[model samples]
Target chain A: MSRQDAPPIYLDHAATTPVDPEVFATMKPYFTEHYGNPASIHTVGQKAIIAVDEAREQVADFLGCKTGEIIFTSGATESNNFVLKGVLAAAKIQKPHIITSTIEHPCILDTCQHLEKRGVEVTYLPVDKEGVLNTKSVQEAIKENTVLVTIIYANNEIGTIQPIAEIGEIIKKANQERKNKIIFHTDAVQAIQYLDCNVKKLGVDLLSLSGHKFYGPKGVGVLFVKEGTLIEKIQHGGHQEYNKRAGTLNVPGIVGLGKATELTSKNRVADSKKQQKLRDLLINSILKNIPDSHLNGSNKHRLPNNANIRFDKIEGESIMLHLDFEGIAVSTGSACTSGTLEPSHVLLAIGVAKEQAHGSIRFTLGKDTSEADIKKVLEVLPPIVKKLRQMSPLK
Target chain B: MDHFRDPHNMGSIKDPDGVGEVGNPSCGDIMKLYIKVGKNEAGKEKISDISFETMGCAAAIATSSMITDMALGKTLAEAIEITNQNIAEKLDGLPPTKMHCSNLAADALKKAIADYKSKNK
Candidate 1:
């Protein structure tokens, strides 16, 4: 039960994790037996409503917030859009400014870009070589007209954990000193699995998460909007989700999210410890055994289950294909942008050379990863790197 | 895997008649093709030798090897007829997304041939 006993080692948990069986079991009833519109005014509808209310409470309990604070969306992308656009639109301030780090997920960055064209001023703060954001840079970037500050809790490609608490504290102090209520948001989609997600503990007024990233069903995510956080409705529909988002609920997915959050809150401590050991072993062995290979991000401030590595004079796509031939699955970077053949923006942001960025590969461990998986990777990687190097033009 | 592991004609041809390099670093692929021109018994220009050095994915390397194998011993005119599809077919067809690699190989070969022709003229 420690590792998935399979041919292809699933080492891309940062992209998505397989749904837990227990979470699936909890979702089955909502799809079939308890199938009813939560908005209907009947007994079956009431039954569905009870299930939804319970799920809301579960997610709220996991995030340590009130039940009404959690709003379900199609996925994290929509949740992020809602927060960024909704806050700015509702603010109604002239030329409202926003602050975010350069290493944010595309949803945040793209949304910010779109908002900028509409008289919004946005500042993208750069991270250090290790992909860690400087708190002072964020403080300096906050203008008097800055309406919101959104930063990703952990980078998807590099697995760098930004100083979320420190940034939050700075924002809190800035709001008090300037008497400007600049809302703070963190896209915790990558952090929900192994990091502490309590809203109060992180001091984030708005947080975003996707179900699929944490062993839940896809197409469902939650955005934690703190009480009294003024936000306008992005989607117009009947009175569902308090009219903030208007659509019939994905009941099964919501149930799955609730269960996934509950399980992650309970098991993350032990899971992180186990994955950290495997991850360190993988990183150390690859660094020690392979020549001219380097780790991509911070050694200390990174996710427990992630490793981004680069080998000199070798293409990452080649390594991915060779590893695929050996029945081991990995990624060069984010799956969302895999087919584009562009070197990772995160790598470039961290000051990695373009040639080195092309050679970067990401290996993320999960709860099911085992000792045998690590052994297989160690045994398989060197020969593949060697073969690629022998064929490489630079080598 | 076969062509990628043991490419047909790899490495640079020393003191070659012409060289062609295709692809950019941002695309994560760069291919350099070198060729030697010679006169055949039929008094026609033929490619005496062809080799490639590729920094790319499996498909890119495979297509480079395949193009070199197809171009060697062929007349300049015949080599000029080679297309991305030909190189892909020679390798049992690459994925749709990877067809660009075959394009890079064919383009590099044509550039090398053009270089040889212009230099000789």
Candidate 2:
């Protein structure tokens, strides 16, 4: 069959996911019918307040935190900025410091750069060739002035799962020896659907997650701030969110996020198992059928749904466009796609050469992925790669 | 996007009169231009055929295809005068970020003309 007649396949779930139907249904009523300002004390407004509270409880339940600890924000970017700027703004020490990994999302890295301009010291720790951070590096980077440690739980590009719990334990021990407590934060936006994220188990004082990452609505996120963690509000306005975040609630988006979180908690284990199998099938098939193709991240410690593959001679953007023409959606680590003229920082951090990084493509599965999707990819991808390689001059 | 999907005049000409390569693999764009030179009715040297092989983005491939179409059958002097803007205009304009891809395409054509001149000299 011609590619124009084929059904489109979505393999870029790491970028964003479509809202779950159940989550959408749960959010529908709040948009028009139950629409009221949560700040209002009237019966109509009180309903919105109740819905928002329930969402907080649902998110809190999933993360094993108290309901009061959940603070709703616009999304993970805001949540991440809130933690970095908020904590440092409230720090009592002179010249506060933060330790973060080099492979963190741009939200974290950019926030750290913005903070650095204002005299806050930041140490960006490096990762291994497999994109795994050594817990000892985190321990050694902590100093007397270190006030916070933030890291990404799972990378968006390569899908390498960092050792967050081990790093958290190292911070826990470090905090015991210091007079000033060092707060631990993690950007868990990409890990919420496939990993264990209970705050207590992870030893995290602050955590950030976005709704759209896990089959929920966009423009809504949660920042888990432990009771005793010191953080000043970044957005100053009203008395909402216990004066921690000062904005009217997004009732429908919160409802969707809550429903999505509840469903993820219920089906995470099964979903991970299914995606891992399909992901392995896709990765193994491509490696077997295509010559000079290499996997980008750690095979054992990577996310269940992610497969980043690099071709020897062809550029990633060309391959991505070819696959897109074949009715498949995917992403690339190449500078051409990002408009930045620089390759993915995560891939570069893992020591992938610039040319190899330009040749890498990322395929992330989701709860809806099946064996048929893997088969379709297997059928279409080999030919596409071969064609692009034929047109490539690198060889 | 159309040019990217089905590029015109792809691949190299065997024993071509001129060959020009520009950009680097590490920069995420490398275009190699091949040209066949022949005499026109007026006995002036003109391009008989042109083709390209590129390893880059959709913009890069599309620009390479567009430049080949724009330069084919033109005299080397006319081909060298085809600017990056002309290629982008023929392709209905590229994104600001992708303008550099068109530049690389123009540079490759210029390099090919230079190679042809050096060979005949």
| Maximum-DockQ candidate | 2
Q: What part of the reference interface contacts, as a 0 to 1 fraction, does candidate 2 reproduce? A: 0.73
Per-model DockQ against the true two-chain complex:
0.48, 0.65
User: Which run of 10 residues does model 2 chain A get worst, by summed lDDT?
Assistant: A1-10
Q: Which ten residues in a row have the lowest lDDT in candidate 1 chain A?
A: A333-342
Model 2 residue A20 lDDT score: 98
Model 2 spans with C-alpha error above 4 angstroms:
A1-6
Candidate 1 segments exceeding 4 Å error: A1-6, A334-341, B1-6, B88-99, B117-121
TM-score of 2: 0.98
Indicate the residue-level lDDT of B93 in model 1.
80
Alpha-carbon local distance difference test for all models: 0.89, 0.92
Q: Which ten residues in a row have the lowest lDDT in candidate 2 chain B?
A: B1-10
